[model samples]
Target chain A: MNRQELVNLIREKQSYLCVGLDTDIHKIPKHLLSHPDPIFAFNKAIIDATRDLCVAYKINTAFYECMGIRGWESLQRTVDYIPSGIFTIADAKRGDIGNTATQYAKTFFETYRFDAVTVAPYMGKDSVEPFLAFSEKWAIVLGLTSNEGSKDFQMQRVGEGYLYEKVLKTTMEWGTPDNLMFVIGATQTAQLGEIRKLVPHHFFLVPGVGAQGGSLKDISAVAMNADCGLLVNASRAVIYAGNGEDFAQDARRAAQEYQQEMAAYLAEKLAVKQ
Target chain B: MNRQELVNLIREKQSYLCVGLDTDIHKIPKHLLSHPDPIFAFNKAIIDATRDLCVAYKINTAFYECMGIRGWESLQRTVDYIPSGIFTIADAKRGDIGNTATQYAKTFFETYRFDAVTVAPYMGKDSVEPFLAFSEKWAIVLGLTSNEGSKDFQMQRVGEGYLYEKVLKTTMEWGTPDNLMFVIGATQTAQLGEIRKLVPHHFFLVPGVGAQGGSLKDISAVAMNADCGLLVNASRAVIYAGNGEDFAQDARRAAQEYQQEMAAYLAEKLAVKQ
Candidate 1:
């Protein structure tokens, strides 16, 4: 999906909500276990339940990768099952040397058909540039992550600003607002406004809203741009909303609540712009 | 494998050589394409020919992931085909949140049975600590990469030291030398001596020996500890040594040359210690 198309989808839906499919087979309802591919079945139901409520779905590749070949199959099936026009993200934090990175670009973009794949910027521009080479596809580089480890290197002082600030500034030069995005944790709400000022036009895939204890209101308030340039992701809180056979229904409820909250945020932002 | 076991393997082989299986389907000998699984077939042939000379095999995950399910199958088979006691590395530069990192730890260490998996440290300690939790398994965090892009964040000055230096110092606290290693690219020979001083006991998986134009002698001169603490990797130069029917034989010849050079380095180091 192109920049204009994604922005239009977010506008039309009144929610830049991205439901993260960090599905764990063990966490799924027991009834679904008997099925050949429980992960895919669970994801299909969740997509069916919440497709209208969100603008994108982010599949955390680590969850599927643990199952070996079967897991890979489930990943392919899950991505295939999601409806088109809704942006897809392969949350595979992959990066390597130039040629090796091109192969990874082929894996996520060509083979898996994800609209974007999260990439680590530690290896720098060459590692990330391969993913940005694709038309309409995106390279969401790690900026200020939500995890405690984010302080290890990302928050360390680099020149005049933090390391992540350097990452955001330097990486933006490699790709435009159209193809490059940044994964700025929603937990870093204090920095969101400053980050927005840094890269105002580029979209931010903000993970850590639900189970990670980030406030949706706080993140959306500061981070949303003229195009509602933010994809607020919620994983565990939505997917495992209930553990019984009505898990999908419960997940839909959780998603609807987030969508409703996001809708209000979008409306308020639009009204302010007008 | 533990630190002692790896050191012993290097001593027994008289080489700290790591053969990289960066098998590209398009680049493989045309004759092998007739086989049902050419990637695995090519990997099998290469392993058979060079298993004794090299102490480890580092499978670059990108080449396999690009092929999708069949590629994953090939990755499994290739790892399984390697003889026991030869350390296997899934050169999958993966990192994410704590929970997600656990799943990745499971994917490479538990499911794939790799001895070590390279991890990008842009996300920090939580992203790395899970990989360290697995007994005898290795995390192999990226310290200084071989690519030109390494200069982007890694070479950026942070306080008194460079960014990669801070990465090395901070990440070292999360895991002992037994379960943790750092990828200090062979291309950065000038810094190897200093990096060795920073983390004297830890192993370094040094890539960019041949095709990327890194000097083996210079790296070994400064980086080699008493245990021969280096797994210098040469992928393209060694793996794609020939394009004809004798490709595997030619690969073996290329690997043998590297092993011979490494053995000489080890012998000199041992002599100096004595």
Candidate 2:
């Protein structure tokens, strides 16, 4: 999953949206809740419905983990459901000691077959380097998060620049933009320019746009690089749009709207490139 | 599970040791590898041998995750095998958006019944606070990691302190020391004095002391507070001590050595207090 290939996928699909599979059995439609495997059933329909509208699928492992064994099965099934061409993310937030991280890379890359796994760079290089060692795999390190706590550490003034800026500058040495990306919160629209200055070429997996009150237009305008360099993820705003039997269809409709918006953003980007 | 209770337990056991159950089925003894569930069998023996010696068990999720369903089952069984008095940690370094973080909290605290879980604080407060919200449960945020990469971001100069110092100072307000702990790499013995200044009251779960070449004596001297405020974790150096059939006994011996060293550290702390 190189930068050029990701950009090409977005251009080919005319969409930069990444639908998040944060599916919970209890949160799905009541009619399907009685199904033997509600989480997988919901994920299957969601993927089927929105597969054409998006370029990627982000699976948050926490929702599936709550159901224990059943949740894990749902995760494996959902990963299998997603098309190979589309980027698949295991939003596992994994980072550990070097050897431990090597094992984690093997689990997400070999055992589960995810294209990328979200990594926390707080542990520095050893925790993140193992993930980058794998071919075609990415280490999406957290930059400025959209949460209220973003002010706690990421935005705190560290030396001359913000802590996140320092992280971006230092971690750049670990891997190239091709094998590394940054998770810049969509809500931190004001910081995008500063973030871009730190890592101008790297892809930013921008979350907090839909349900978390971040504007897509603001994010796209401020963050996009020469490449259509953003995978704006909308989880609850898409998947849980309607908790009734039409949940999947509603999800598709929400995804289509995001895709349509992304198409315009990328089109403007291409127009600039031309 | 509360603060004082945990402190008392650490005192009564005369051990601040937390044996990390980073059990890889492939790394287990050949005799156990032939069992119906190798990881579980190995873990069960380890638990049986060391339950009385250690006050806590830290289950690093990656080892279990690699085994898939059977690994998860082993994790659950391992959690069950530990006696009620000991603390349990799902060393699953999880952090995400608010809603998703709530699910992670539910999974580890509610589903798996873990007393604590490691979290990467890079995503800011929202990613970590949800984990901290649970009563008696902990969010062990990564402070100074024991890896080559620690030189990258964590140790980077930020203001008058390091970036990790900022993380410790800022995030400390989000949760009380009772429910908040920091993962200070045992290898960073020299910086423990400064780290102690930043997070004096909170418990520190220090790793990298054994196979990673960190000094236990140095860590205890600089990091310990009034509460014997440290849980020194040794994974490979303890769990994988021997690959032969006597692996569990070897593990016990290694753990006993750590316990004895920790007892010496505690005695020093008591002397300092007196």
Candidate 3:
């Protein structure tokens, strides 16, 4: 999806929510285990239940990858099942040399048809530039991640600012806001405002909400731009809300609540811009 | 494989050569395309021909993933087909949060049973620790990459040293040389001696030999240690050496040349240590 199209979807849905499909086979409802493809079955229900409540679906590739070939089959089916116009993200965290990265771009963007794939910037510009080369497709580079490990190297002092700051600044020169976004953890709400100032036009995919204890209100308050340039992702807290037969219904309820909260945030932010 | 086992294999083979199975469908001989599983067929031939010439086989997962479910099947079969005691590497530059990284570790180590997997360190310690948690398995974290883009952030000044230097220093604290290694490109031969000083005990997986213009002689000169702490990888230059019926033979010939060159280096390094 392009920048304008994603912004329009945020406005149309009144929510910048990106539902993360970090669907683990072990965590899914036991009743579905008998099914041929349990992970896909579980994902089909979740997509059907909450497709309208969010603007995007971020599939964490690790969950599917753990299952091997069958997992990849489920991943292909899940991507095919999601309706178009809603942005899709392959949360693969993939990056390599230029040529190898091009193969990765083809894997996610061409084969799986995701709107964007999250990329690690440790290998630098060439590893990331391949994904951005695809038109309308996006490469969400890791910035200030929500995990405790983020302090290891990302927050290290680099020259006048943090390493992530250099990442955000130097990477922006490689691609425009149209084809690039940053994965800014919602847990880092304190730095959201400052991050916004650095790359005001680019979108931020915030993934630390809900189960990770990131506040939607705090993140949206400081991070949202005129176009509502934020994709607040909630994975476990929404999808695993229930373990019974009515799990999909429970997921819907959780998603609706987040959408409602996000709607209000959108209203306040949009009103301020006007 | 453990450090002792790997060191023993290096000595037994007298070559620290890692043959990269970056098997691409289009790149393989046309005759193999008619086979039910061309990729697996191609990989099996290459493995059978060069298995003795190299101590390790690094499967670049992107090529397999590009073909989707069938690609994954090929990957599973290829890994299963390799002879025992030869080290295996899943060159999948994957990393995420703690829980997610656990899934990745399981995917490569438990599900596929790879000896080691390459991981991107952008997310830091928690992202990388899960891979190290596996017994006898390895986490080859990206240090100084060979690509042109490595100059972007890796070489950037961070505190007293480069960002890659801090990565090498901090990441060493997470795991011992037994379970941890770093991906230091052969193109960065100038920094090999310095990097060896920082993490002398840990092994280094060096790529960018042939097809990428990295000299095997230059890399081994300064990088080899007491245990021959280096696994220099050559992908396209060896695997794609011939395009006809003699492709496997050609690949074997190419690998033999690298093995021969590496044998001399191993002898000199071992002699100096003795």
Candidate 4:
């Protein structure tokens, strides 16, 4: 999906929400447990319930993989089930040798039909560029993650700046804002201002709100780009809002809350653009 | 497999060779293309052909993933087919949020039953530490890659040393040598001496040796540790050595050449240890 279509979808729904379809079978409702494929069944219900509230869906492949082949089938079905207008991400953190990585790009973009894929930048541009080569698809590289252990390397002093900053500056050269986005976790709000200065024009997929205790208001304030700048994801809080049969309804309510909050951010973004 | 067992297997086969099972459907023999699952058939042939000659099997998930559900099934079967004594790697290059990575570790280690996984360290330790938490399983972190684009950020001078060097030093603390390893490309042999000094005790999974033109003799000279700490891999040169019906036989021959060279390295390693 193009950036403008994403912007318009957010405006039309008054929501900059991207629901993380990180469907773990054990966490899904008991009612879906009886279905031949519980994960996909739960995912379908959640998507149908929240589609009006969300503009994107982030499918983390690890949960599906934990279920093995059956889980992958569910993931494929879920990807196909999502409406064409919404953005789809194979939230696969993939990066490796170049030729090997080129095949990964092909797998997600051609085989799985994802609009974008999250990439790890430690191996540098070759690892990330293969994902960028696909026309109209996005490569969301990890910038500063929202985890306690980020201090180990991401925040360490590398050169004139922190390692994350060096990664941002160098990786920006491999792809333009149109195809390259950064994964700036919501908890790292203070660094958002500094990250924006490094690559101000690119979009960011911000996670760590809700269950992770990151403030939506703070992330929007500092990390917003001219294009409304973020897809704030809330996984457990939104998806497993209630584990009962009304899980879908509870998920919708949770998503609507984030959408309403994100609406205001997008409105501010539109005002600045005007 | 424990550290001593892995070392013993390496010596028994007279090889530190890790055959990359990057089984692309199109690259396999045409006879297997008609099978219900082509990827698995191809992997089974290659494994059965070269199992005795190699110490480990590196399964790159991308090639199998290009086939979607069927591809994942092949990946599962391939992992199952390899002998228990040999090291198995899910070359997924995965790293994400901590809880998410914990699930990934469960998928590869618990579900798929792999001995190790190649992880990207850009998101820092939280992205990688979860993978290291599992006992006996290893987390192979990205160091200096062999790709041309590696110069983009990995090789950039950062204060006193390169960014990758800082990654190596900082990430070393997350796990011990028994559970942690680094991916130092075989072509980057010039830096192996320095890398050896940085993480002298840990094992390294080195790719790019044969078709990528890396020298086995040189990497062994500079990167070998007291444990014979290396799993030098060659994908295309070994697997695609002959595209005809005798492809598997050619793969065995190619693997033998590397194994013969590695035997000398192991002997030298024994001398040094004594």
- DockQ, 0 to 1 scale, candidate 4: 0.72
For TM-score, candidate 2 versus 3, the one ahead is: 3
Q: What is the TM-score of chain B alone in each candidate?
A: 0.98, 0.97, 0.98, 0.97
Across residues A1-274, which tens digit of lDDT does each residue of candidate 1 receive? 9999998898888888899999998899999999989999999999999999999999999999999999999999999999999999999999897889999999999999999999999999899999989988999999999988888888999989999999999999999999999999988899989999999999999999989999999998898889888999999989999999999999999999999999999899987764
lDDT of 3 by residue, B167-236 (tens): 9999999899999999998888899889999889999999999999899998888888889999999999
Clashes (backbone N, CA, C under 3 Å), per candidate, total 0, 2, 0, 0
Worst 10 residues of 4 chain B by lDDT: B265-274
- Per-residue lDDT of B1-274 in model 2, one digit per residue for the tens? 8888889988888899899999877677788767887787888888888887888899999888876777788888888878898998889888776888899889889988999998888778778889888988888888888778888778777778778887888888889988999899887788888889877899999988788899888988898899988999988898988878788899999999999998888987876664
Give model 1's docking category. Answer: high
Q: Output the lDDT of residue A235, model 2.
A: 92
Better of 2 and 4 by TM-score: 4
Interface RMSD of each: 0.6, 1.5, 0.8, 1.7
lDDT of each: 0.93, 0.86, 0.93, 0.86
Tell me what fraction of the real C-alpha contacts between chains A and B each candidate also makes: 0.98, 0.81, 0.91, 0.83
**Candidate 4 per-residue lDDT over residues A187-254, each given as its tens digit:** 88888888887888998998889999899999888887777778888889999999987888999899
Question: Which candidate model has the greater lDDT, 2 or 3?
Answer: 3
Candidate 1: global Cα-lDDT?
Answer: 0.93
Off by over 4 Å in 2: A1-4, A272-274, B271-274
- Local error of candidate 2 at B209, Å? 1.7
